[model samples]
Target: MAHQLDKSVPIPLYYQLKELILNDIKDGTLQVGDAIPVEKELSAIYGISRTTVRQAVAELVQEGWLYRVKSKGTFVKAPKIEQSFIQALGSFNDQIRDLGMTPRTEVLELEVIDVPGFVSDKLNIPLGSKVIYLHRRRFADNEPIVMVKTYLPYNKCKFVIERDFVKESLYPVLGESLETQIRKIRRYIEAVESEKYDFDYLNMEKGKAVQRFISIGFNYRDEPIEYSIARYRGDKNSFEIIITAT
Candidate 1:
């Protein structure tokens, strides 16, 4: 049953209506991908003006709880997956599995290539040095979540080029293969317009927003061991950072 607007309270009518919609979603009256009633219908049901309904819906849309289709209607958007890896360093598969979601990976490209200038800078390697370039797309419960391109010094990580990344996590493999374990990571996060690789590998639309994660991994010796760029779909991913008083 739909909630009735309580005019006796001091709360704004639009906010009350928005809360009702959220309640419906929480109670399973509305599900992800379900279309919400139009402004006219909501206005009529709530005995409010269309302007009021618009305000409530617009706020929900802005907050990522809803989305508008050009000619179709408004819909309850799927809740974004929380990227726990951002909060702590761990295997992606293990982190996702802890969230009760199955994780899968697809190795797209694995080759030994001369380090690009950008990779050279990040890894602190010579420009012409060989690096093991690995490209992969990661999925959670069959939905594509991120596409990562990683570069590691060939002399230390050449064995990685032959390993099956689809069945293994890179960090663990690196720890076992190399003399040192990854102890620190420095990351820069930015929002960027989606490009061709996103379209092809991530099934993202051209010009859609993407969250780019640029990270450099250092070993116990403080030597830069890996440089990676991961692009996550903005609509499907959310990050959480925890700060504690130490």
Candidate 2:
């Protein structure tokens, strides 16, 4: 659909044009993989310069709404690759399994290590205290989706650090081996750009966005027992929160 910009308005031409294109995608008038009008055509129809069209399209591409193919035109991106992330804070393995997808784990590092200061503070242990650290790569349908680093006080989960995590998930292992239950957890989530490990494991572009989740978990006694940092592929995951007003 052609959108006319009122030159009389104060809005920047490129930005105004961008909203028009964005609306089309949001409304599904531009379906996934659908090619948008070429720059020349858009410029002529919108009464804007080709330069303005290029700028608008560049922003859309960077924002994950559109993608370009060499020697071809730009097309709407596929629907965001996302999964169910609810406020209940279920394990990723459980969530993925319930979705009928294969959830695989690659045990990158599973052993006790001297705790970093940040981890020590979160788990309420002394700095340099030994902690069971588990570095794992989590996948769905064989596609890497998250990198997880979990720190547990050595006294709390030392028995778990030596198990074969490649065949089992950490939460389940904790329950079976230590009879530990997760009573509560606090999570801080934020958007971030891909780090080096994300690039290597998730096959994401270095500048692409990721969702970082920092969690501190407590046991039945309400004592903090675990601290973990998990980074999920932003393009592949989203979260939902259900609220009830008191």
Candidate 3:
């Protein structure tokens, strides 16, 4: 879709152009792996200057919605895996589906156990409290993307152990099956390098960068019920958040 530039808008021309391309990506007009029209073509069609087009394209590239290949041109990239902390709550499978990727989970381990002191504190539970633990490897289009370790209060969600996580997503099970509705979540993100978790479950190479997502979820009664740690392949995912003035 092409349209003449609007000079009256407060936004910069290139930023407006960026949203146009991004809309195409989101609306399926530009499917993953499809080559975007060259800058010259876009400039001629939109009646915008080439420099403006370039600026828009550059921003898209940096934001991971498009990738450029030398001598070939730019192409629509697989949508980046994003977690909108600002919006506050979404399941991993749901997030992957939002990106139009097939999400699959492989159950690695499920059991009940006691966690270390710091972990117990983070979960807001007393030491020695039994927690139901789940270790899973997640894939997008059959490529290993993240390894997750989830701990839930056994007293609250022991039924989770009997359910098949590969078929029933954990977050949904917590709400629909266990009656543990998640109302709030506190999240922390950090960068890390490949570790044992990656070697055992993820297909990431040695020294490859990873992004660690640590989250503690609370139920409707403001009781902490879950603590989860997910390590995502940094090269395969991107996390976006919006911050506003208070």
lDDT of each: 0.89, 0.84, 0.84
Candidate 2 has its poorest 10 consecutive residues by lDDT at: 78-87
* Ten contiguous residues with the weakest lDDT in model 1: 175-184
Model 2: per-residue Cα lDDT over 88-172, one tens digit each: 6577878888777889999888788999988888988888689998999998889888999999889878788668988876666
Q: Candidate 1: lDDT of 4?
A: 93
**Model 3 TM-score, 2 decimals:** 0.68
Ranking by TM-score: 1, 2, 3
Query: Which ranges of candidate 3 are over 4 A from the true structure?
Result: 1-79, 177-179
| Residue 84, candidate 2: C-alpha displacement in angstroms | 3.9
lDDT of 1 by residue, 1-246 (tens): 277999999999989999999888878899999999999999889899999999999999987889999999999988788876775779889988987899999998999999999888888888889999999999999999899999999988877777899999999999884453678888999999998988988898887899999988899888999899999999889998988999
lDDT of 1 at 6: 93
Model 3 residue-pair collision total = 0
lDDT, residue 62, candidate 3: 84
TM per candidate: 0.92, 0.72, 0.68
Clashing pairs in 3: none
Q: Give model 2's TM-score versus the native structure.
A: 0.72
